[model samples]
Target chain A: DTAVSQTPKYLVTQMGNDKSIKCEQNLGHDTMYWYKQDSKKFLKIMFSYNNKELIINETVPNRFSPKSPDKAHLNLHINSLELGDSAVYFCASSQQKTTTQETQYFGPGTRLLVL
Target chain B: DQQVKQNSPSLSVQEGRISILNCDYTNSMFDYFLWYKKYPAEGPTFLISISSIKDKNEDGRFTVFLNKSAKHLSLHIVPSQPGDSAVYFCAADDTGRRALTFGSGTRLQVQP
Candidate 1:
């Protein structure tokens, strides 16, 4: 059983296409995050949701939107894809910890290729 | 601007030796540090972490050392095995912020 999972492990599409990547966590976490690993292999935070509410939105493009229907699910929708958007996206979950540091569990990344 | 930096892009070590990976951060607000190991085609796995209050934390054969003054941290793997070969990432977080800033990963290869 996967603690965190994403659908369409591999996505190949042409530029200007619209696609969505779905993420789910079964670990009963209240916080979820989306990270993009660019060609340089730097994992940067795109968005974060806590208890199904938007909390952190980095300086990402407007085309990328994140929606959390519930605490267990967070989905990312890209309006118009571009060749520069080709990268591996990862979803992670963590139980909010204020006393000590909390560890984030990640799901198998979805490698998106835009031709 | 890259807040976190991993100077070494790749590292190689012999089996049964020690492997050290270094990371430096420019954000002084970051008080919590973590190390994550990732293999190709897989997500990063939580390895170990240390709070700014402490200088070191260890689990199994993995140990993490932090120097707040230097704004630097390092991960040490003792008796490095071939299975330990993977990309190691160093992450830093602020005291209250749950978001993490990750450094450019260092690929470690343990030769047999």
Candidate 2:
């Protein structure tokens, strides 16, 4: 079984369409994160959730929202997607530890393309 | 502004040789550094990591070196194999947060 999994490995939609990506982790981690990798291969953190609470929000657009229903699931919803939103989205999770020694496990990325 | 930077966008190395990938960061608060390897259509997998307290960490063919003073870190692979060709990303852990800052990835091509 996969430790972390994401739905819709590939998504193609119009620029104005709204889409959602689902993510789940079986690693029993308390911290979950969303990252976006652009065409330039630059990976940047979009948001982070710890124990169902929003912890870190980077300088992402307001059209992007992240929801964590429980510790095991985190979903990302993009409203009014734009051409600039086309990228590979990754979901990651890590255990809450005293030190930064905890390793983050990532799911297979979801490639989204906006026309 | 990007805190972590990977100046080299791509690298080439011959098989059975050594491959060195470099990364620099502007944030001194990052106490931990990690390297991840990613193949096409797949997520990045953790390769190796180094803590600020230690200068180096090695595992089998992979080694990570950290220079806290210079805010620089590097990943070294010995006896590089063709299978080792992949995109390598350097990440830093913000000391007080759970989020990781990643640098632009470096694609390594190990020629056989």
Residue pair clashes in candidate 1: none
Each candidate's TM vs. the true structure? Answer: 0.98, 0.97
Candidate number of the best TM-score: 1
lDDT of 1 by residue, B1-93 (tens): 999999999999999999999999999999889999999999999999999999999999999999989999999999899999999999998
Q: What residue runs in model 1 are displaced by over 4 Å at the alpha carbon?
A: none
Superposed on the true interface residues, model 2 gives a C-alpha RMSD in angstroms of: 1.2
Model 1 chain A: ten consecutive residues of lowest lDDT: A96-105
Model 2, stretches more than 4 Å misplaced? none
TM-score: model 2 vs. ground truth: 0.97
First chain of model 2: TM-score? 0.97
lDDT of 1: 0.95
Task: Name the best candidate (by lDDT).
Answer: 1
Worst 10 residues of 2 chain B by lDDT: B93-102
